[model samples]
Target: MATPKHDLPDDDIEYVSKTEMKREMTALQQLGEKLIPLDKKQLATLKLPERLFDAILAAKKITANGATARQKQFIGKLMRDVDPEPINELLNKLAGLSDRHSAWLHRLERLREGMLADPKIVENFVNEHPSVEIQQLRQLVRNALKERELQKPAKAFRELFKLIKQYIPEPALPGLEASGPEEEDEE
Candidate 1:
């Protein structure tokens, strides 16, 4: 059996090789495909080059699978010409924000569960979040607990989750806060 030739010295071999380069390009192509599903506004947030951005928009308009695949390949080629590091970084940040949002939601679920399990937890939550509507929250919790005991439809339970979510402060998506209510008022 023949051994593969090393293009760089043994120490430098740890760096990127031809196989790695191909893998990176494939990954970039996959990322481009992922971007295609995003709306135009979301794509604009990525700060992509005008040509690449135009290609992505054009790609989104294609209905044929074969043409879309070809357009994705073209986007990958364009990705190679631009600096992918910043693009990857921004993607990672967005992913991290999504993870944090999920975690925050989970925390709210746990809090709701804890409140249902112990009456004291309700007092504690009310104390911590004084701005919360105490009477409404207590009513929702009582109704949810009663529904659980009776095995009725979980309407109250769902409402409790909605109320809990309202209390939890969520981080806004990038580029959205700027154009929110304040911008509308200015116009």
Candidate 2:
């Protein structure tokens, strides 16, 4: 295949090619799809144009596969008119937050598992989190272990996770702590 001729030398031309533009639009549409699954509060944080926001809301309501695909293409077209850099940045931040939240939850799960496997861990946990209710946590752990042994419904096991989440303060994300205390003052 022959290479397409450029009007000027590659270095002289500053504009993106048609193919590159199409790829960018496609990427933005995929970003829009990701945003669709987010709740209203999360979507509000993006600060998208009114028309584009309405389009996303409408696209989300579309259940038919063919129509949804078509709407997504339309959204891509709309995205071409808007600056995608900020949108991409925000999406990356949100994704990072989700990853951090998942890691935090996994850490809690491992702590719970460790406590259950070794009763001694409970003493260590109570010592670390002095505000935690020791008796309540111990009772829950015991019940959770019994539930696991009997292969019954995991009610106590789930409760143990909830209790752990409540008692153990979430590790603050870097850079977020600077603005942390000020947020409470605004409210």
Candidate 3:
């Protein structure tokens, strides 16, 4: 083999080896991942029809008014080209959850009133309802107690029920206790 000399003025030389090619391949793969376009299925996942779409569109209109023509186009294409079934399902689930949460909140509001009327219960609530901000809970408690005070007949009925339950629990059951195992274990 002839030993190549530097005097042979060649402008290009092979510097890229298998290791460098592999490194380049990995870097290109990462870049390709970042550049990959969202498929129709992935796009459809965000076009939530009910509450989520309403929320997103409201926000989009507010923020996107300042965006350029290309940005607007991109957003419009994204919204239209995507599959929306997942979004609809998610929104339905969220709406259901919201309804359940609201029912719980109403129950909590009723409980808050009961607690406010009873100082002991109020103290217990103040300690237990950690998620309810202290100031907000205090205000709600005040309102509930005031409303309860305004309902004289209801208050009286509740008090009477409490008293009745406290005193009228003397009924006896003939056989309420468990009768142990029914048969001996085979294994």
Provide the overall lDDT of each model, using Cα atoms, as 2-decimal numbers: 0.74, 0.73, 0.41
Q: lDDT tens digits, residues 1-187, model 1? A: 9999878778855567899999989988887776777667666666778999999899989999899889999998888876665455445545654564466667878888988999998999889889989999999999999999999998877778777766666554443331111111000
TM-score of each: 0.64, 0.59, 0.27
Candidate 3 or 1, higher lDDT? 1
How do all the candidates rank in terms of TM-score, highest first?
Answer: 1, 2, 3
Residue 88 lDDT in candidate 1: 56
**For each candidate, how many residue pairs have backbone atoms clashing (under 3 Å)?**
0, 0, 3
> Model 2, residue 183: what's the lDDT?
13
Candidate 2 C-alpha lDDT tens digits along 1-187? 9989978888986888999987877898887777677656555556677878888889889999999999888787777776665565555545654455457667888998999999888989999899998889999999999998999998888888888877755554443321111111000
Q: Kindly report which residue stretches of model 3 are placed more than 4 angstroms away from their true locations once superposed.
A: 1-86, 89-97, 129-144, 147-187
Question: How would the candidate models be sorted by lDDT, starting from the highest?
Answer: 1, 2, 3
The residue-by-residue lDDT of candidate 3 on 1-187, one tens digit each, is 9986896467666667999876755553332222124333332344333432333344334545455334433444444433433433333333444343345434544554465567676556557545545565455556545556786334433432232223223222122221222121111
Model 1 alpha-carbon miss at residue 4, Å: 27
